[model samples]
Target: METTRRAGAEIALTEMPDDGARGDVDAATQIAAYRIVQEALSNAVRHAPRAPITVSVIADAADVTIRVRNAQATAVAGVPGGHGLRGMTERAHLLGGSLEAGADPDGGWTVTARLPRHPAPEASEGTL
Candidate 1:
């Protein structure tokens, strides 16, 4: 959050359960969620410095969904690659989740990652 703010962009966070409260989530899931936000903010800060960015997290009984979006910036150049996306994707995947990062056809970029409440067996400590 501070990352994008420091870069001159306004950042807002929204949670599904409402009131912005983080309720009953596991450590690994929480860490993965934080990392996803961190990486998304890093990308916006570096590429769309003055754009508006929103981070939304939705959690239900079975899964947690996160979406980060930066407003369209006509001034930003041809776009950047990598930008911690690979690490973010790996984090999501390790948590029995999936991630998608892409530029919006109209403008800007969006990153979405979803993690399951009960992660799969393959997402073990050694696998990470």
Candidate 2:
């Protein structure tokens, strides 16, 4: 996947099971969920070179979740800010989803995102 992306410079790669939708997931939601994983992988590569990146997507009757983890990045010299993490969070929020990013106790950093099966409108229907 990385090699293919590198070849195109601007292309992004996504991997998912071929079993079709687990439940009620729509096309838009699935695309957004994959984008979250793609962005997370890009960030891990760009910010923590040489670190191993793991991406996983799981779907069930209720939601789709994406997880990306990488080893801790050693502090680099003279680097600027990183908006990849922030941008990912914003994307999740915009889709009425949630994102979690933090260091793992065993070592390394991890990001897990969950986007509900239903769209925002349907999800918010009964909220007070």
Candidate 3:
């Protein structure tokens, strides 16, 4: 949040679990979740400078879901196409999770990731 704010974008925490309320999510899952949001926020700021961004993290008994949505770009400065989205998706898939990113129908872009709270043991063993 501070990172985006520092980048001159208006950001908001639309939803989040209480501290320590994430339940029994593993360390790998936790780390993946953080990285997913990190990349999402970076993409938003880079592709839609000055746009309003809303971030939401909802943790349930089964999985932790993250959504980062930004309003239409006020100024797009990057050349586009980077490893950010791919890295984010790989992280999720490694943890038996999934990620999707695309432009919203109305306008703007949104990235969503769903990471299992208790992933299968073999899923992270490079079989993916």
Candidate 4:
């Protein structure tokens, strides 16, 4: 949230997932979540300064939903021509989840990802 605020955006965090919602997560999952928010905020700051942003994290027994949206987006820094979305998507898949990022019909940009409540099981040694 501070990232967006620092980027001149009026940020609003409507919801944050509780500890219970996080469930039995692992370090990689936590890092991925943090990175997703970091990249989203950075994009909003770099491309759409002064836009109002809403970020929410909702979690259930099975998965957690992360949403970051801006009211309007301009071509200040061009489209996602970098590794931002790609990295986020990779991280999502690593956690057995999915991420979707695109422009909203409301003329804003939105980045969303759903991550499983539990981390992917580690492959046992000598097991395919």
Candidate 5:
């Protein structure tokens, strides 16, 4: 969130750990979540710099859910096309998780990823 702010974006962030257990998530799971957020933030800054962004991350016993939403762009920056979404989807699936990205009804974009707290052996072994 701080990184996005430094990039000149106003973000509203919400982070919560279920049962008040902040350390419930494994290192690998944590890393995947971070990367998803990182890419989402970067995309928001690039595609909609002046739009308000809201990020929510909720971690529970079974999984971590991350949602990054950016309002409609206030200015036309440039064309948008990239492999960021693909990479994010692959990372989540590799961790026995899932990701969804698309335009919101309000003319914005949203990226949501849910990664298991404990991935299967094979899934975790795969390169992200």
Candidate 6:
């Protein structure tokens, strides 16, 4: 969680170049991404409290990849699960994206979301 916030703060401080870019995301989407990370971190802290959590965000010419991974179920008992995971999934879908949540091969939980750069056009020019 701390790592995630630090990363977001760092990115927020960095400035972008002046070169023309068509796929520049608005503040809303950026906020959404940040929120998603926050939610993921919170979940990890609550569910797998003692586990180490890693949140990564990578933006390239094509798309952005957000990943959150934490150590598997701890020895402790009584960890209820449902709402938070479902909410995260829905949020990703609302943005025309997808979310994946499952156990990692190396014994951990990994949640990843990929939001494409180009979404479907809302309407055609002459359709109306």
Instruction: Write the number of the candidate with greater TM-score, choosing between 1 and 4.
Output: 1
Taking the tens digit of each residue's C-alpha lDDT, what string does model 6 give over 1-128? 45745544211222233224535754434555666777777776666666777767766554556888877656346866658778777666666767898887877887887654443443111111
Candidate 2, residue 37: how far the Cα is off, in Å: 1.4
Higher-TM-score candidate of 5 and 6:
5
Query: What lDDT would candidate 2 get against the real structure?
Result: 0.67
Residue lDDT tens for model 5, 33-84: 9999999998888888789999999888788999999998764556567999
Which candidate, 4 or 5, would have the higher TM-score against the true structure?
5
Q: Single out the weakest 10-residue window by summed lDDT for candidate 4.
A: 119-128
| Clash pairs, model 3 backbone | none
For lDDT, the strongest prediction is 5
Best by TM-score: 5
TM for every model, in the order presented, reads 0.83, 0.71, 0.86, 0.82, 0.92, 0.68
Candidate 4 lDDT tens digits, 1-128: 77557646788886665667444655566667778988888877777777888889887777778898888766575445678888888888877789999988878999999877666576111111
Instruction: List the pairs of residues colliding in candidate 2.
Output: none
Ten-residue region with minimum lDDT total, candidate 3: 14-23
Displacement of the residue 54 alpha carbon in candidate 4, Å: 0.8
CA lDDT scores, all candidates in order: 0.80, 0.67, 0.82, 0.76, 0.89, 0.61
- Give per-residue CA lDDT, model 3, range 1-90, as digits (tens): 796788687888866664465567777788888888888998887777778899998887788899999997765655567899989989
Pairing residues by index, what is the TM-score of model 1?
0.83
Order by TM-score, highest first: 5, 3, 1, 4, 2, 6
Tell me which of candidates 1 and 2 scores higher on TM-score: 1
Cand. 3 Cα-lDDT: 0.82
Q: What ordering of candidates by lDDT runs from best to worst?
A: 5, 3, 1, 4, 2, 6
At residue 59, give the lDDT of candidate 5: 82
What overall lDDT, based on C-alpha atoms, would model 6 receive against the true structure?
Answer: 0.61
